[model samples]
Target: MSQTRSDLRTIQPSARIALLSDIHGTSSDLDLSRLRARRLQQAIEAINGECPDAVLVAGDLTENGDREDLAGIRTRLDLLNAPWYAVPGNHDVGPKAGIADDQPTSIGTAAYEEVMGPSCYTATVGPVRITGLNTSLLGSGLPEESAQWRTVERDAEPLPGPFRILLLHYPLFADHEREEAGSYWSLDPEPRQRLMAAILRADHHLIVSGHLHRPFVREWRGRALIGAPAIAFGLPPNDRSVGWMRLTVGGDGRVTAEERPLAVADEVR
Candidate 1:
């Protein structure tokens, strides 16, 4: 029997995971309603057409803790047709941040969990252990949330696998300065440095994040750390449109992704 083009392609293991991050209420931004649908359909088609097993929303699933924002994210993501998981971003919380919310602040965990299910948790797929870290604890004015990284790092016990991938909203290591981390709502050097050390010490294969909103791919020694472009809106210092990533996690555990802008008419060839 001659195999169809799709059939000839290897379905990424039931262990494969589709990652999404930093959506931040872009669900209704401009023509994003249609673009979002198409981007998601492309991803689903990649998963179903190539047939991956699961999808994971890394973080920043909403712009704010607005019910409408969160609900919209959940609805679009539900179309993936597989067991899905998510972590929370700074915007997922109502506002108070590091503290629990009572009046629905904007950057707290409780608000995110209300819609996304849980702010921080773990899901295992095949021999892989995907740990979703909540870096949003370190919000716009809060560095104390950096402590949460300790909890996740400490609780990240040894996993009996060839790869351990940590997914989060903020990049622990970024192309930013120590004094600049606070301004950008990113992890300070100490927290980020420690987190990177912990991940490396634990022998993780990859660490992925999206809060930076810029797209970058770099490898330390041989390990890869990816910064994904936000699907909601592109980052500052540039005029690019919104984009999403297609990550191919290899069997030998090398990770690669291409950030494709959504509103552009020129497609990936």
Candidate 2:
């Protein structure tokens, strides 16, 4: 018989996932790129030391989604002892049209897929069911948008897992679920509501995201929403700690997250 939500809670804890984001890796040999590479290496080593069951990269794996850069980032990530999954951030897939920026045009979905597999995917890791989404396409009116929506809808159906984790590049909202959209840092309003509704249907217990370059944890509708720290660098006006998140789901379906900061000594100028 398929397990019910209540049954899942009683299952023994069985998963440890390392969450990292905003790697900002690049193929360039510039100083900033070199620093980011070093930080990424340190972060990977830290994660390995934790001996996680799996790794989830929230997005921005590359500085600009350059094929070479993405390839290089992938090579580094492969060093992790655990299998890893990732979604795409704005930097990896390009922002929606009309956004102002000095960055190059979108790398286009095909190129990104060539390196990162798929922009959206669902995987089972131990007792958790993880669904990764591409927030950049949330409201971009692109052909892939419809397909992704179907995936979201599919995810809403109950699945047999002690925990369900929704992973994405952008947080559904910064402060409150009712917050306004059009902010460069978050998903637009319309898609946000739809996505939340679907998550509610599935009763997802946790939502993990990275993009703000800051780390925070908030509870909404009894679900934990976590903003993971950036692995490449820090942004001001926030935690700004360059590191990663260690998330553990216990047997009782309780989720705990710890921030693992990269040693200051490892950060070289």
Candidate 3:
């Protein structure tokens, strides 16, 4: 049931890909959980209406990395009409070292692979090459970290596509590339620089991620870094409407992205 690189269907030219993130699904019947589920369902319906060629989920698929929660979210994602891929957010795979110690320890790579397949993979979608990474393992020093780094190096190699996308859970930085790290919201400086080096070598055009629970776009060394809005809920000091992103790649290889908001019933809030 794993959708590996070879198993992924080759999308046609002029692909329309739907981007969703931070679903935070749970099996419990709490009112908030029900609201999140409803929002996810609405997002799926909207994505199917767009008839995207593929879908990329940016992670945080569950409130916790529990097996039941992961399975529940996977079942909801299956409703998408198009082929879909996902990376694990901190919530889905446990936090990195020195982060959220009060919560469960890092789930390790194997537990995640059991439900989500390989933690790192590359898929071809017409003119685009999408590389998904397991950010949770980036600085964790787990054995899997070395293997994932190899994959990152391989990403720089020439591929069939002119456009490359890096999909992961954490934002490289909250504001600027030179900003200080150790903030709970962004990747630490060491791994951030290392990853950026690989991205520069690969000339990745776009980097998409979640975990900020807000939507914003910024440019880092000429590449677009998009913070996908949370499908479960949005943070304050900005529009809190839950939503998804619509990314379109033209036959000419021009890529554009738009944010589409999904409305939830006020009573549910």
lDDT of each: 0.60, 0.81, 0.78
Give the per-residue lDDT digits (tens) of candidate 3, residues 1-269. 11112112233366777899999887665886888889999999999999998899998888777777787788888999888999988888777665865454345456667887887998876667789998877787877788879998877864555567899898898777776656778888888899999998887767889998888776566667778899887886355677999877655544567889988765244
Evaluate model 2: give its lDDT.
Answer: 0.81
Better of 1 and 2 by lDDT: 2
lDDT of 3: 0.78
Model 2 TM-score is 0.90
Q: Which 10-residue span in candidate 2 carries the lowest summed lDDT?
A: 1-10
Model 3 weakest lDDT span, ten residues long = 1-10
lDDT of 1 by residue, 1-269 (tens): 11111111122342454566666655445565555546555554554554455566667776656677788878877777766767676677633233444443333566566767656666677656677767755442445355456556775565545456677776765664354444354566665676766776666666777777777777764556777676655657354555655566665454656555555442221
Off by over 4 Å in 2: 1-8, 101-107, 237-240, 265-269
lDDT of 1: 0.60
Q: Could you tell me the C-alpha RMSD of candidate 2 in Å?
A: 4.4
Q: Candidate 3, which segments miss by more than 4 Å at Cα?
A: 1-12, 102-108, 160-162, 237-239, 267-269
The pairs that clash in candidate 2 are: 13-251
TM-score for each candidate, following the candidate numbering: 0.74, 0.90, 0.88
RMSD, every candidate, angstroms: 7.3, 4.4, 5.7
Task: Tell how far residue 57 is off in model 3, in angstroms.
Answer: 0.5
